[model samples]
Target: MLQLIEEIVYQVTGKNGLTYDTDFVQDLALNSFDVMNIIGKFEDHFDTTIPTRDVWHLHQVKDVIDYLAGRGFTQP
Candidate 1:
């Protein structure tokens, strides 16, 4: 799951290096547009809808994993 999330992040941000603690904004320098794009990709890949309110919680790679886990997604 982490690897998949990293791939999505890389696809969206075009950044190869990332850590679980990396912040999308602070570390990856992703603006709102980039975040939206990432979110769209995530939704498409996961086949889930992330609530707009919950989007802010996904600030790090681990956060996204946790969110997916909470949604009943297991590591593939």
Candidate 2:
């Protein structure tokens, strides 16, 4: 699951050195457009739809993992 998150973040940010603690907006400087793009990719990868409002709640990689877990996406 961690690797999955890493891959997704890397794909979106084009930064392969991301850590779970890395802040999407601060560390990666991911703007609103980037966030939207990331959410879209994550939806496709997880095969689930994430609400736009809820996307703001995700600040770090762990937040994404928890959100996906709530949607029953167990680590592979």
In the range 43-73, model 2's lDDT, one tens digit per residue, is 8987778899999999987787788888899
User: In model 2, what is the error at residue 2, expressed in angstroms?
Assistant: 2.0
The lDDT of model 2 is 0.81
Worst 10 contiguous positions by lDDT, candidate 2 = 13-22
Quote the lDDT for 3 in model 1. Answer: 80
User: What TM value does model 2 have?
Assistant: 0.86
CA-lDDT, candidates in order? 0.83, 0.81
Scored by lDDT, the top model is 1
Model 1 lDDT, full chain set: 0.83
Q: Model 1, residue 52: displacement in angstroms?
A: 1.2
